[model samples]
Target: MTDAVDRAPAHVAASAVLRVGGRELDLARRFAVMAIVNRTPDSFYDRGRTDALDAAVRAGAAAFEAGADLVDVGGVKFAPGPPVPVDEEIERVVPVVRELAPLGPVSVDTFHPEVAVAAIDAGASVVNDTTGIHDPRMADVVADSDAAIVVAHSLAAPRTQLPLPHYDDVVGEVAAFLRERVALAEEHGIPRERIVVDPGHDLNKNTLQTLELTRRLDELGDLGLPLLVALSNKDFVGESLGRDRDDRVAGSLAAAVYCALHGARIVRVHNVRESVDALRMVEAILGWRQPVRLRHNLRPEGNG
Candidate 1:
């Protein structure tokens, strides 16, 4: 029988690399972990734990030390609450980006063109636009810089309520949306190598719709770009397992591993160490990564 690793999708091949922030992320050789460094006071998961500048910097440094490949800094909460002005958003995230860029590649999670430009100027290497570049200026700014862009699919604008979000076919629609956005990004002068596509989970998508997208996520790889998935304690896991945000680590790890096996290149996660460990285990099993120590059954003396 053919080894399962041999059947891995084309997107996960060793030659596939994602360029961002003057670095080449070997997506196939080692799955990339983009740790969450939220600077938002009302973040759903941490709930203001990293809102303070010092706390945010410490959290990002610790995640990098714990094996995270990059840190994603975001000031405003993705959910609706209050409008954060462009200047306020810039103030919240740019400081954290300036500090964390020295540790590893920094990804600024924002759809605002001004915020993206500010973060990039502050040393951020990736602009993760969850609104899928609804404002075309976002694409323009990213194109002008040497940074990469994550084109995420979301039905509504940030901080807007979209009750009863509908999709005739969630996976197909998401794939189509990402494809179109990626084309637009390229048209805006952002090179194909500097682009990543995300099927934004739980963003204007109900639990059932999110679950369907997760199941058929591989279809998105047909777009032939690096796939970045933000599946860290999302509402889908919470609703599916009946667990709160704080209790969804195991479920999140399970979903992350499944996605990695199915060709997900990068996973943006809140629990960095756990997500890193889970992805490393999957990578080792698939022969993409080597075990740190392999002396378990190699002792000549036999079992003690």
Candidate 2:
């Protein structure tokens, strides 16, 4: 197998730290988990379970208590659905941001400049623009605030479906797109430390493409920015295991671990507690974090 460093472009070097939401994550030493809290009624996973203001607030708090490093509140579903006016989007997300901000770092998953600005004003520290900050104004919003931006690679606008996304080399193409987006972000005043990149997972690709991308995820480190992989209960996981959305947790965790071991520094996930435990175990095994307890097999007195 080719080494991860060997796979990376020799001309580029990976980033060592990620700065976001007044927090600095040492990418080389630890991984952070960003919990998903959707305020949309038609979210593919939870399906309105958290659309209510109270429910959304509770969910975000619980996720943080469960060891999530950050909470991502998204007002609109990522899938192609009816258009949600900007005002409604703000109304749905801002209050949640206001409530969650005091607890921990909050990320607003949006592509609209207006929504991003509102969320930032409401105390969000990150703008997760799945459209790769296609709107220059979105970049301005992040630049104007102390928040960071998550630039994701997608072939089409949100709510628009690509018939069949194709790429001669998915990893290379995605890397190229992210490099351009990252450069655009810098051009708009966002610094490299405050910018993160996402591979967009099943955003525009099919199962095969997504799997291939996962296989070569380490190549993306060449971009030298913190990598965020959102692999929570995605279509690729379900399809790969011949399971449904509700049954993809195991596969999701597997893929997330694989990505983290490769190059992912942050994982955006729906199953916060499980993902947290899984990643913590990985961290401990890699010696980034010490084991919570070393009683097991230490001696006969402490042995189970």
Candidate 3:
């Protein structure tokens, strides 16, 4: 098998500008925190906590106040369960998107092209497709709108169970899949600046595969686009640490740090405050950001 580094393309600078909903984000200088706001009753993490429109809106506002750079509102859970009709999905996300648009950049998590269109109409600037463009029309919908698109690598349809995932090389395969999807988006008229890619941590992967992907995440940067990683209390971390969903904060933060150091420019997380702090610390360490109000360590010249 070829080494991961050898298989990766030549390193290119991470995308500098990402335009969504008329707002431009400078990815080179700062990391983005995408807070998850699930409107589905059966979401794995929240589990109906924000299923109501009002509750979802409140959660979005709180996430923004907690320092999230973006909020991703999803109408359906990714796990298999009851099917959500297009109208129901639109109803679930459109209102929340409309209410949250003024707060910051809003992204709608869905694979349905019609839902994507409605969410964009309601002020969402990005479509977070977990199926990696399962619907052929999704790319066209995004291309016709001003919204950006997140092309996540998933081997199966959303909400379907992958009993066992077998990969010759997880990271390499994921990168190739995303590269193809990115080209598909561009071919549909969605410019490079309006696209992002995700490795879909735990979506169709087991624990070991996810860890390998995390360790070799930089290889995805060779695609020459900003990387978005969803590492918020995921099953991979939980299974690795023998912890439950609520107890995976520390592990999640550690994974987030690793991803950010490697090349991930955006992190989708459930804990906004901690993720914000962790990413900022990583950026400061990398010299991409500065310390806030530094004064505690300064020594007086006369005393010295």
What are the root-mean-square deviations of the candidates from the true structure over C-alphas?
A: 2.3, 3.8, 4.9
Q: Native-vs-model 1 lDDT?
A: 0.89
RMSD of 1: 2.3
Q: Give one digit per residue, the lDDT tens place, for model 1 in 1-304.
A: 1365685555553337778879988776678999998898899799999999999999999999999998999999899887989999899999999999988999999989999998999999999999999999999999999999999999887789899999999999998898899899999999888998889989899999999998888787788888888989998999999998789999999999888867788999999999999988877777766689867658655655
lDDT accuracy of residue 246 in candidate 2: 92
Residues forming the 10-long window of minimal summed lDDT in candidate 2: 4-13
Worst 10 residues of 1 by lDDT: 7-16
The C-alpha TM-scores of every prediction are 0.95, 0.93, 0.93
| Candidate 3 TM-score, true structure as reference | 0.93
Give one clash count per candidate, in the order shown. Answer: 0, 0, 0
lDDT of 3 by residue, 29-148 (tens): 578999999998888898899999999999999999999999999998887776889999999999999999999999999999999999999999999999999887999999999999
Superposed model 1: Cα runs more than 4 Å off: 1-5, 13-15, 300-304
In model 2, what is the error at residue 252, expressed in angstroms? 0.3
Clashes of 2: 0
Candidate 2 is scored at a TM of 0.93
Among these predicted structures, which one has the highest TM-score? Answer: 1
Give candidate 2 regions above 4 Å deviation: 1-13, 299-304
